[model samples]
Structure formats: structure tokens, C-alpha cells
Target: MVTVKMLKPYYIKADDNYVRVILAYQYFAVFINNKVYQFVPIESKEIRINRRTKKVENLGARFAFQKGKDIIYMAMSELISLPDFLVQLHSIADPYYLNKEIKSEPNYESEAIIDELEQLNMKRLIDKALDNRDYEAFQSLVKLL
Candidate 1:
């Protein structure tokens, strides 16, 4: 079962093999396997990643990123928090990105690509969700689409 934990994966280091998650607003304590790691809020919209291809052995329980730290390198990527909310809003949106992650491809039950020929007014759906206070639905669509 996949669920949004209100945490957004802001960065991933292939060399270091660490996934940095940042909270949208408050500092959330991520409890993974009994260890609690604090996530300082992310102010920037860009995804920051380390470019140096170096091996890091200490894949520890705690990783805290804050302001004033020097950015080694960054990828031109963007993702927002509240992903599950977005999914609930887009009833006819195609979920290509979500299906790509499934090990068992052709997750037919979930990922049926909606007809792109019919213009999906993404911005309108988003605005309506915001107005209706349907954040959960909005978040779901945001993560996959």
C-alpha cells in the first residue's frame, strides 16, 4: 500500500545513496525504524543534489539540511509537498510517472493514461481544489502527475 507521509523527497544522491526529505512547512520528525530524524523546512523550490561522485559509508539515521549550507551541486527539478491531495483532484489525469516506478509494470488497476487530446485544464483543477480545501486530493495528483 502506497501512502503519502506528508514528506517530500527533495534530493537524492546516487553516489552517496542518501535521500533527503524536506517538509513544506513545519519541521517534521521522520521516524524510520525507531530513529527520529528532524527535517528542517525547505525554502527553495529547486532540487539540490551533490555532483561529486564520492562514496559515503555512513548512511546513518539522521540527516538535517538547513539554510546557509553550501550547495555542492543541484539538479534542475521540482516537486511539491501534499502529493496525494493532487491525485484525488485529477479524476481523469494520466498517471505515467507513478506507473514508471512500479516494479511490476502495467499496473493496470491504477495507471490508465487519460486522453491527452482532450485538454486537461491542470491549473483550473488545482485552483478548484485549493478553493474547496481538498488538499488530500490535490497532493495525490501532484505526486504522480
Candidate 2:
């Protein structure tokens, strides 16, 4: 029986389309029949996950990892059985999603303040143009209002 011992990603990068998870040596490991097998990315160091579907995208037919001098192969089918691994993976990716959500949310208070300031500045410019008897400048500034 295979069980995940540790699955901490070295770093995670996410965009609107996908989340890329990079793993390094000693960072991800598993246990098979109570024997530890450390995973080392051989074919590719990065795992690509679709953001919308939350599914592995770049994983080929089977992904290979190194354990000591021996290379072990794991299929996506095998990985699906381990609920703990999936849960931890999602937890690691959760922060990126939360950050995207936070960024997408509009800061209404700050936006209102900035708009008010711009209007006041434009009004001041219009008044100055009027005092200087610059009809062209006054007209342009008034148009901006």
C-alpha cells in the first residue's frame, strides 16, 4: 500500500488558466509498505493544473519520480486514490486563488476618493484659466469637467 508522507511544493505559480506547482528533492515523499520513497522530478519539475477544472494538465501517461537510485513510476489513476494527497495539494493552491479573488475585488472607497480629487483639481485648473483670461484653456478644462 502506498501512502503519502509529505507533499510540500517548493513553489506555486498561478494564472487565470492554470496553476504550476514545482517540487524539489526531499520536498515530496511517499511510503510504500512502510518503506519511504522520496520523489524527485525527472521528466519535468513542474506540475501544471487547470484552474477551472482543478485537474492535472501536463501529466503524461505516467509520471516518474526517483527514489534513491531507483526510478518509480506512478499513474494519475494511482494518485487519485489518495485523498490526503489531493486535499493537501488543493490546500497549497488555495492561497493563490484567494489572492486572485482579493485582487479582482474593486476598492470602491479608494476609487471614490481618487475620482473626487481629480474633479477638484480640474475645477481649480478651470478657475485659474478663467483668472488668466485664457479662453482656450478655460474651454478645454471645462470640457474635462
Candidate 3:
């Protein structure tokens, strides 16, 4: 039985398409048959997950794990079967999604301020047009109002 022992990401980079979890040496570990195996990235150290679906998009071609100099190469498929692994991965990735949501949400206070400013500028322009007796400009500005 394989169980996730530790799955700490060095950093998480998220964008519209993907969330990349970069792992460093000893950052990821698992228990296989009561033995601890620490993952060592071979080809790539990053795991790419779909931002929308939250599903893993890429795991390097192969990975190496070490247990006191006894190194073993394993395919990512082996790890995907463990429910605990997915649970932990999602938990770690959830915070990045939350942060993205917080950032993407509209800032109502700032938006309100900007709208007020634009309205004030428009009113000032209309007043100026009226004072100058520019009927065409006044009519256009009033229409905008």
C-alpha cells in the first residue's frame, strides 16, 4: 500500500490554464509497504494541474524515489491510484485557487470611485458646453448623460 507521507510544494504558480506545483528535493514523500520513499525528480520537478478542472495535466515521464540508497524508478500512474495522494494534492492546491479567486473578483469600492469620477467629468464637460453656448456639443453631452 502506498500512502502519502509528505507533499509539500516548494511553490505554486497559477494562471488561467494551469497551476504548477514545483517540488524540491525531499519535498515529496510516500510510504510504500511500510517503507518511506522520498521522491527525486528526474526529468522535471513540476507538476502541472488544469486550473479549471483541478486535474493533474502532467507528471514527468518517470520519477525516482530513494530509501537509504535503494533508488526505485516508478511511473506516475502508480501514485495516481492512492486516494490519499489525490486528497493531499487537492488540499495543497486549493489555497492557490482561492487566492486566484480573491484576486479576480471585481473591486466594487474602486469601481464605484471610478464611476463617480467619470460622471463628475462628464457633468463638468456638459456644464462647459452649456456655458460656451455650443448647442451641438451640449446636445451630444446631454445625450450621453
Candidate 4:
């Protein structure tokens, strides 16, 4: 049996100046200021040998969203994770209100992840946090709920 994974919808936000995309625990890309950084899904390749004919076949995956493109592969021996990268982005946009709008919107990855979890009936966690007067947690949860 083939195992099927349920893909969360790609989180996207757009303004006249920028397009921000987050693929949840995977990667995020922000397109703005005439530059774009993308962290996208990638797959590994393997070589299979047919016993009967001794023929070798290379098998790999093409990303569902990035079809028909020449892919250049690169690896960083040491690198920051997506969450950290997002934090860096927020830091750079500081004093510019990129973290949230005036009313504390759910404008970041952590909030987006919480929103996804809440869709799975995890509201009680938020309620408990609110009950305990965890204002920070409450603020994060209240946006998407």
C-alpha cells in the first residue's frame, strides 16, 4: 500500500510590494525588492540495476510544484533552518512592521503553524493558554481561530 501524506495548503501572503510563501516546516520564499530567496522541496536519486538485463536506471523525483525547470543543486554543510531564516527576515524588516499588522495579525510561520494545528481540533490548547493568562500564546492563537 502506498502511504499518502496530507499536504497542508501552501501559506501565501501578497502585498503590492512582495509575495511571501511558506511551505510549513519545509521552506519559505519571499519575493520582493527585486530579489527572491526560495527554499523548496527536493528529492534524492538512486540507481537501480535490473537483474535480467543488467541495465541500470536512475530514479528520482521531480518536485510537484517546480516542473519543467533546470535544477541546480547545492548543499550547505552548515546552515540555518527555515525558522531561523524567517526570524532573520523579520529582523531585517524591523521598524517596518513586517512581523504583524497594527492589530497583531498572524503574520509569521509560528502563528501559521499554530493555525494549522488548530484546524485539527487543537483549540483546547489555545483555550488553556488563555485560561492561564498566557497573553503571548493567546495572542498568537486568537488570530487564526
Candidate 5:
């Protein structure tokens, strides 16, 4: 049986001779050395693997790949990463008024928008963040929660 390892380093040699690294909860596997080498974190929308110089590249979401026996899968790099409290906080944005002249430049009524939105509208913001691999955003939202 093919053991489905959770949250561990997984290396697979594609038929094209490239190694792909499977990351936990990530959509695409990292490719390198004409073979997938290692997979990055789930929120890394795009991770570049350079065989010649060992460089990292970024590609926001828009990912695609094939699994064993020719099963294709797709997912975005951006996805909500906020914790419980932050998620709840971000959901209620319309109720309050965001002032742009008070503190920061793009001052929102409340950064809580991100956290609460992700939690309530789980389908929209949360999914979007993961698809784009925006874990940093998720982290910020989490703190607020």
C-alpha cells in the first residue's frame, strides 16, 4: 500500500526525470535537478527550484501537476492562514468604518477584516489565501483573532 505520509518530506521522480517534493496541504510539488527536489510550505504560492544555481522562484497561485497513474490536480498558492480568534475578527468588516487618515497609509477600518472574513466566508477568503499561498496574511489574521 502507498503510505500517505502527513506533513513530511516526500520525493517523487517524475517520468520526465524531474524530482518533485510533496509538501503537507500543498498543491504542487517542488521540482529540481530535472527532478523534483523538495516541496516548500503550503502557503508558498510559488517556489522556484533551480538545478544549476539552486535558486528559488516565486509564482503566485495558478499551479498544476499530475499524481501517480496520471491523476491531475490544481490549486492556488494563496490561502487564509489566520487562527481562530483572528478569523472571527476579520469576518466583520462592513459593520465598522475604516478611516484612511488616522494611522497607516492604507488604513482599513480594521485589519480584522482578513481574520473574520476567512473564518465566516471560509469558501472565499480562506480558500483564496491558500490558493495564493498567503500564509503571512493568514498569520496576521490569526494574531488578531
Candidate 6:
């Protein structure tokens, strides 16, 4: 039976020899398990209805990235608290060219290429995101396309 679980957001320091999986929004390093998997965003739109008020309201988007055949789905919102090194690398800082510096670092180039190819079909990906009610993802696709 396939097991599902949430992966706490973790960062692998520069000295670590783990595989880094880069995505459009964020990146992660799988240190313990050298596993092949894909993360599928679960719902993009989260609607909540008050029982007493009987009114439906849009809650901030709730999403989880379902991982691999094991089917673990980690909530993206829960990961929001984690620092995004990629973003931070590109952002203004004393080491103004940190982004460029990190480019030379060890990245799973093959996996990165695979991710790019998977996302090559912008229209199809956008359609899927739309179907999931993920407007943010849809907008990102628009910019990418």
C-alpha cells in the first residue's frame, strides 16, 4: 500500500550532498531518499461556507503538492513559513550576485531539465491549473508562455 504524508519544509545547506529538485515556485532537496516523484497541486480554490450565515466565502487558496507513488501531499501554505533560498538568492543582498554564484553550485541538472520539459506544454499545464482552480499557477503559466 502506498503511504502519504506531509514533508516538513527543509533546507539542505551548501555542504550537503543531496539532490535538489527545483520547481517554478520553490526548490527542495531530498537527502535521505533518492526517490523519483512528482508533486501535483491538489485544490487551488478553497471555499468555506459558514453554517449559520449560510454564505459561501473564498478562503485564501489552499493547496497541497501530492508527491510520488507514495502519494504524500504536503500543504504549500504550511511551507510558506520556510525561507525560499532561491528567491533570497535572487533578491537584493550584500552578496548582490548570489544568484549567479549559486548557478555554478551542484544542482541536479538532469532533474531540472525534466521539470522544464514537463512544463514545456504551457497551455496544457495552464488548463490543468485552471481545472484545479489555481489562478496563481494559471497566471504564472501566462507569464511563462
Runs of candidate 1 with Cα error greater than 4 angstroms are 1-5, 8-29, 41-145
Q: RMSD per prediction, one decimal? A: 24.8, 9.6, 8.2, 23.5, 26.6, 28.1
Top-down lDDT ranking: 3, 2, 6, 4, 5, 1
User: Candidate order by TM-score, highest to lowest?
Assistant: 3, 2, 6, 4, 5, 1
- Model 4, range 1-145, lDDT digits (tens) per residue? 1111222325544443443333442343333233343434664221122323322222232222221363433222111223453344344333333333347666699988877876765578687887899998878877766
lDDT of 2 by residue, 1-145 (tens): 8888988899888888889888888888888777788876765567677886777776554556666677888876676568887888887776555333434679899999999999999999988998999999998988888
User: Which numbered prediction scores highest in TM-score against the true structure?
Assistant: 3
Positional deviation of 28 in candidate 1, in angstroms? 5.1
In model 6, where do residues sit more than 4 Å from their true spots?
A: 1-37, 45-60, 85-145
Residue 109, candidate 3: how far off, in angstroms? 14
lDDT for residue 41 in candidate 2, whole number 0-100: 70
lDDT tens digits, residues 79-102, model 6?
333345223322312222123233
- Model 1 over residues 1-145: C-alpha lDDT tens digits? 2222334434322323322222343333333334443445333332222223221222322234332352121111211123452342122122211232437666654444443422265656766888899998788656645
Single out the weakest 10-residue window by summed lDDT for candidate 6. Answer: 12-21
Candidate 2 error regions (>4 Å): 59-61, 98-145
Q: lDDT of model 5 at residue 94?
A: 19
> Whole-model lDDT for model 2 versus the true structure?
0.78
lDDT of each: 0.36, 0.78, 0.81, 0.40, 0.37, 0.41
lDDT of 4: 0.40
Q: Highest lDDT, which number? A: 3
How many residue pairs collide in each prediction?
17, 0, 0, 0, 34, 0
Candidate 3: RMSD to truth: 8.2
TM-score for candidate 2, residues paired by index: 0.61
What's the residue-level lDDT of 78 in candidate 2? 76
Question: Residue 29, candidate 1: how far off, in angstroms?
Answer: 4.5
